[model samples]
Target: MSRPQHFGWFLARGFGPHGWGHPYLDWNYRWTEPALYQESVRTLEQAGFDLLIIEDAPSLGSPATIDLRVRQAFGGPKHDPLLLAPYLFAATQHLGIVPTVNPAAYLPYTAARQFATLQHLSGHRLGLNVVTDTGSARHFGTAPPPDHDGAYDRAEEWLAGIKALWNSWPEGALIADPARGRYADGTLLGHVQHRGDYYGFDGPLNALPFTDGEPVIVSPGGSGRGLGFAGANSGVQLALAPLDRESISAYRAKIHAAAVEAGRAPDDIKILFAIQPVIVSSAEEADRVVAASRDPDDAAIAYIAEKQSSDLETDLTALDLDAPLDLSVFGGHVSQGSIARLVGKHDVTTTPLSTLLAAHARLGRISDRTGFVGTAGEFADLIEELGDWGNDGVLIWGDLHPVTVHRILDELVPILRRRGILRSDYVTGGLRANLQAF
Candidate 1:
């Protein structure tokens, strides 16, 4: 297999709690402007993004404090990611849709059938982001004695079963005959019976593997169990978010090393980092726009603090805006502790009050992290730096959807094409074929 250079876009718009913090009903109104999804997919297709990673959660929950607003916001029926991919694939020829699915809640047969059907319909424009049940166990109401590691043990069996099911049908199984009115040959359809630690499944996956081998496999698991899962199964792409150069390099090396251990080529996996690029026509204009996207009020900041670590109501309201933010108040670092590590790595010590206050305005910036907040050329320069700093590419994010998408497509993409870092037109084929892998 020829290893193609990898790059992809992430779509967490409807289900992820990562953006804007809008209520569920109001989410589509604010985060996604009218027709933005179609436009964004087109932009990605035109820009030669390898695939669009679509994230989905069966349910949303915080491990620590239950943020009632957050829960209420996500409590409604969500857009089924697997169900949505066909429509998205129909709309675009080259862009692949990788939807995240939890292995715990659904059966392997059902999951396999749905994905196979999707691959058949889209001509194989699909990828899988396998999220083990660890991160959302409590949220799913399946109280776990099995830690993430245990869940992953179960996940291995699930993956194996899924693969067996996908391969159940032999090649040339479909022979539509008019004389006898036969649609398929029974000899081609084989049974896959599996009885494992976590699950017992039997039969041929009730669908055809597209003319291609299968949809691409992608995952974002960095934990030991997640790593093993990715190494054993993930082939085309891997997703991650690292705040600094050292972490980015380390993560890339880790992925390459994992591939080697898995008996796969080291460069087989592509790395795409998650970033919300706030680009505008000018540097000052970009900064102004980014600042505007931040909440000037305390409620949102407090909510972020609660989600990230411990409660910080007392210390958050008492610091100078210009001073370095201190991490002393939460006793240590809280949830998303990497934010703390990034701060300490850059020597950005400040009162919790100051950090919270600044978070409401500066967004995820500490003293040193960089975001694309400038003219098209400047954004391109930063993107190149990220690539040189050892990332395969950057996955652009928006503070607000359509606005961000419009600016990126109009501004940044053209500059990238001129610089030869991004393609001017999509390669012809399904998602995997466009990415140039078997």
Candidate 2:
């Protein structure tokens, strides 16, 4: 027997160029305009997706890496996803739109007000993918950014202040009795005063109270502090780990433990792993795709190098391909996990840079159970297996382009529905309700 699981799409490219550097570029959908995203999200809703998480990094790297970031449009040149959320809401009624938000960017009062407005406008279908990145501190003119744990401390304060403002208005505060010629009972609203180590705010938020609930809180962090934050505050955890039964179970246990420590039920938070599967049409085609990528040419390697360079903010294209990569070249700001991902099983001391680059460019076929390259049926089998493992759901990651959305969902959706692994209809309330339906 198979149980239904939640599904979502991750807009990995943020609000930057969609379908750029791909065959779909010829579609000319105009990334700056809303029509492209609106159409894409409509398709997602029709497929019964629970939400769409839009990724954003609000900074164009430091001066040294600006060109690398934008030269390939891998990073930066992004418009605010928060601004893009309203248009997405107008296009679809049920699919939750989660835009990335940083605590460092906005004051507590402003962020609470703005988020409250969106949650009401979307009819409680809005979500916030809260991020703790402090790299954009310079843009906000705040004091210097804090260290790892300190950043989480600031985010904790920020979230607490926002919640206090949201709850300032008591149950009887809104007394909209038209016959009595009364709009609201101002006396019932409480004055909330919050003065913390990182933020200070006094408010009974001007925004109206929610009819359903506050906006869904989504978070993506893998560190101990990050996991603790999710356990304490998040409704959805954007998880990342190897997609195996043992690994998945262990990861989930950790989250459940953290939730217990925080005095929250584990069911309060849904752990949705991020997966990008290459959905092909047939097994033969999958085999051919895998075969083609076994040995990448110079062009393929160069493309991989450019993407890695943008992510690390350290130029890799100029490095000698034949020489061993020096780990010390990476700055303290660079993520050690990212560096580990860039240099997989092979060692940096002995392996040449080209070998490492070529390894990343390689792909494996799903028929052999090696990688994610497979037909719709094969992908469905993977999803069903995840459900059996007591997984909450999986988020299919890709650009928010019409072609990309259709390419993956067209065949995969039907197979999933047939197996009773995907929902065919959504519940009435909103994102929170739909997620809790099963």
Q: Which is the leading candidate under TM-score?
A: 2
- In model 2, residue pairs whose N, Cα or C atoms come closer than 3 Å (at least 3 residues apart or on different chains), thus clashing, are none
**lDDT (C-alpha) at residue 380 in model 2:** 89
Report each candidate's C-alpha RMSD, comma-separated, in the order given: 5.7, 1.3
**lDDT accuracy of residue 137 in candidate 1:** 58
* lDDT (10s digit) by residue, model 2, range 1-438: 599999999999999999889999999899999999999999999999999999999988778888999998998689999999999999998999999999988899999999999999998999999988766777878587788788889999999899889998889889899998998999988799888998888999999998888899999988899999999999899998878888899999989888889999999899999988899999999989999999899999999999999988899999999999999888766766679889988989999999999998998766665788999999888888899999999999999989989999999999899888989998888889998887
What does candidate 1 score on TM? 0.77
TM-score of each: 0.77, 0.97
Reference-based lDDT, each prediction? 0.62, 0.91
Q: Write the per-residue lDDT of candidate 1 for residues 1-438, one digit (tens) a residue.
A: 112235576765543332345333343543222244565677677767778777665643343433432443432224566766666777788777888777876789988888788887877788988776454456546654366567678777887888889888777777667897888887878778888877788898777656765778887777666766777777654555555678777877777877788898765666677766655566567667667756556655545444333222123334454566655644221223344432533456444444544453454322234444566676666667676675566666442254455666676666676666775465545666666542
